[model samples]
Target: MLTKELIANIYKKVPKQNVLSKIEERYVYAFDASDLHEKVQIPDAVVFVESVEQVQEIVKLANKFKTPIICRGAGTNTVGACVSVHGGIVLNFSKMNKILEINPVNMTARVQPGVVVGDLQKQVEKIGLYYPPDPSNLKVSTIGGSVAQNSAGARGFKYGTTRDYVIDMLVVMADGSVIRTGANTIKNAAGYNLGSLFIGSEGTLGIVVEVTVKLITKPEASEVLLAYFDSVEEAVNSVNQIIKHQICPTTIDLMDNNAIKTIEEYKNCGLLCDKQAALIIEVDGFKTVIEAQMKLICDILNKNNAQNIKYAKQKEEADEIWDARHSSMAACAQLRPNVTTDDVIVPRENLSILIKGIQKICSKYDLIMCMVGHVGDGSVHPQIPIDMNDKDEYTRYKLAKSEIYDLTARLGGIISGEHGIGLVKKPFLPKVIDNGAIDYMRQIKKIFDPNNILNPYKIF
Candidate 1:
């Protein structure tokens, strides 16, 4: 819907180097990390926004033309949150990446939406602070994408997700008006908490231009423990036992046999491919108490018939252990031409049943699924590798995906935990959410963007 006149208007709002309208350049913004071939669409124009004013101008222009304005950050989100499914305008935030303020005294950092998550962590950690919302690929993922998806990583069990850290945000509504969701301070007992409405809205509600994130003091000591189990039940039982002991580790992540094998073959991280499941547990606290915690955790694992357990002795060793888990998606990509990852979560008590159900469903469809998850929070990500070029395989993959969501709903779990319901999961969202709730969501979208110009048709 972006006409030549409207494209010229957008170029007038930014520098000459900021706007991209060439066919080749627009093609690059068509897709994201999501492998859903059916949902991909190239935008008519890709505009690189350098400031809040430019974003507002673009939004106003979009509203005027009734064109969709899809905001894009690093575009690393696995749920196609940044894809332009409709022919409109794509707002690239790469030029707006800047850490505006780091208030050490207040323990909050005000940053542009385009700032890299890992880079922000490094900068904050330099001042003896921590921002714990990690989305696996934080090295390249941007703060805007994480905020939009409400992303959490392995550490989510202890530290919570991006929604917990984001105290305030500068959002641009569809009408080109600006609004601050909350104040810069941490504990706001203020009215409504309007920020929550847009945090995980997946760019469907408004465009996030700036965010103020709360930070915590860095822990004195932390270590990762890799434990192997002969059966998935054993690994799950170990998790329950550890929780029963009242020990709160930073993470309780699990990987199934297929995930282990893929990582071993791709990265050769010395992972035991023969193990049915593996748990990566991390404990952090005072240096003196870490040893006691590790000792107790070891006892629990051993009691639950853990085949073998290894703790990282050095920082490099800890990185090596985490590398295996972080490399899961990349490793699965090596199995076939295209790989799709899903997020499903249930209550902790049903974690084992969920895993087994997913395995059975994938096997029934003859799909290769590498499963990994943050078991502490009962979330699972099953990465399935398939050749999209093969029509038969693609059909089977679609069927398997639907069945997996059905199993998740049966186990009292939603289709997504960390990954928001972008285009990939929109079709199945109604299965979990009630019709009344969906109606309210639709009403909210109408109230926010009456013209349906801001990332239109997402999350429904």
Candidate 2:
């Protein structure tokens, strides 16, 4: 409980209007996109700051009170990154949303922590620049959250994830001191690349108040195609052939029959649900080379016995195909009251085995799973829809989840690719990461946050 004097002190640091201390107000920040059934702690207070100085002031206050300070953006992460587990002060960055600067010559965009990813992309693309790190829910996910999780989407196969784009960040350290991780220039041979350490730290290290990300020129042209296969092996063979021919498509996304049927049932998109698997490939480059890329990709797919091929001839058609692919999660969510998605990645050669293994595990558990992934990068997202209220079913779901991670380890893969090891995956981190690495991580955490007040009890 916060004392009256402590509350008054906090009000002195932040405007009275921005401090949320009521039970109802605190309830709003209790959880994020994580499962509602998980144990959640309602924060003592929620504060919104509009400037870096205000953030520092709040951090100082938290230090004095010895309370945890969890930074929040849009709170859309699937791993409970923004959840206030120990419940102290939830620092809301929504009021700090702003694009500080955009430099065309340097191809860099400086932005606040709360800026939406899609909005920044649109702003940059308006000037013929592109920011490629899209974490599926770009419409609502914040740049700060993306950087914290190193988020990436289907485009990650060609352009890397958020970690590759972030050149610098103005981070508020645990002691309320501010530090810039890197410089504005793209190439920094300077001291240690500290920015890499905090990108996926999940707020355990420091709070990112502002970010400067690198951008590239927008592609001149792009096309999308949906290739259907009679079997998963055939789809994997087609992907291998495309890569063998030296065709570097932006994304080679895979959707199993479950995902296709779910999306078709929900959106009525013209998808071949009868097929065992479908590959959504997008090639983008110069205006003149699109046709050749399409032809080469089609040839590869046909050679692998693709049952049917549908290539988009117009921007509208491309959007329709992508919209259907993006709608897979929402469509699966309609199948049950609660849905959980896992990010597991294996080598491209083991992609077929991982997919088949996950499907079999889900079937053994009697759970409904829809599989979709950026197959080109060897990452897969197995989205399972289930009712958490059913005790027996939930028990089986947990077992299936563990087995899937075990299979990923056996296939020489980690439990997470872009998604972070938040509270949900903390138990299985040791299965993928080495013990010495984890020991060093804990030591580093103590060095950065001795009091363990900044998003404590996470990642480790």
Candidate 3:
């Protein structure tokens, strides 16, 4: 769909070293965090865009040539959002990485797209402020990718997801016009909350160039607890019981025995954990406040007949305790070279049932499936490990995926949480979204980018 002459022409309109060809340079743009997508083919060209104006020129030229254009950040999306399926131009935003401004007094920071989430956290904490959205891939994921997908994290159980922290953003539209969606102020009765709307649009609406996010005062004290259970039901119910007690922990995460065994086998880290289910819980506040909550947590776990409840006192101990939970993606990756991870959000009370349903499906398929979740908010990722070389593997994989989504919807759950409806979930979207809403969303996409040039074939 593209040729060297057309790419050369586009590069001629920008700075030197901005354009790439199909042979070797274009190979990097072929894939993303998604381990199983149909396939990835190298794009005809790749462009390293550094500025909003440059993006504008590239988009205009892409529009002129009627070629597909993909906007990519750290390429961390668990879907094919950045894949150049039609072989057009791939635009990488790494060069535009810049921390523009930080306002500690107001607890807000303005940053360009390519800032790493962990780097942003480090920068804010140094100034006595905190950016609390810490995704599992924070060290490698970029803010642009996080905001684009409305990324959530372990902190989401307390601080809420990235959407809650984002105040405003600078987005570049299809025709290269730059528009600001939100304000830095605390509250506004503005026109539709466009900023919130675009937060999880998954690059289908526009490309986020700059972001303004709110920060919070870091908690002075924290406590980590690990509660083990012989049954998933008990472990999941414990989370609800803890919530009913009105003790909101900063994070309450779950790891089934399969997940633990997989991680322990992969790292030989001596988890010393063999229970059927475990909850790695964290509560943060002032020293006295968190201490009281910690006691209440212990009581609840004991009441649930938890097999074991372990506590970590020091900061280092807490870090070590949570390391296994944090390395879930890596642990699962070691299980198979290819993995298809799905996110489903159910009511907090139904977490156990949802997990049970997933286990049933995994067993029925005779698959070696592992599970882990953000138990606080009821977001679980059941990774479907695959050997992509085998064609029949995906056929069963698709069936399992179909049953999972349908079952999640039947249980009053959502198809996706934290992750957006990128290409991977496009087909299932119709199953979850109301027809009226889907039609309106399609209309909105048409209104914004009539030519479907912003990011074609993403959410839809």
* Alpha-carbon RMSD to native, per candidate: 1.0, 1.0, 1.5
Worst 10 residues of 1 by lDDT: 77-86
Clashes of each: 0, 0, 0
Tens digits of per-residue lDDT for model 2 on 156-275?
888999999999999999889999999999899999999999999999999999999999999999999999998999999899889889988999999999999999999998898899
Query: What TM-score would every model get versus the actual structure?
Result: 0.98, 0.98, 0.96
Q: Which ten residues in a row have the lowest lDDT in candidate 3?
A: 34-43
User: Model 3, range 1-460, lDDT digits (tens) per residue?
Assistant: 6766677778777776777774777787888887545766677877888888888788887777777788788898887878866678888888988899999888999998889999999999888788998888888888998988889888898899899889989988887788999898867788899888788887878888899999998888788988789899888888989999999998998888788888788777666556898889999889999888999989989999886577987788788778877666677778677866778999887788899999999878767677888989999989767777766776777888889998888888888888777778888988788889999999999888888877688888
What are the lDDT scores of the predictions, listed in order? 0.91, 0.91, 0.84
Q: Write the per-residue lDDT of candidate 1 for residues 84-115, one digit (tens) a residue.
A: 87789999998888999999999999999999
Which residue pairs clash within candidate 2? none
Candidate 2 displacement at residue 49 in angstroms: 1.2
Question: How much is the lDDT of residue 346 in candidate 1?
Answer: 94
Task: For candidate 3, give the lDDT.
Answer: 0.84
Q: Tell me which of candidates 1 and 3 scores higher on lDDT.
A: 1
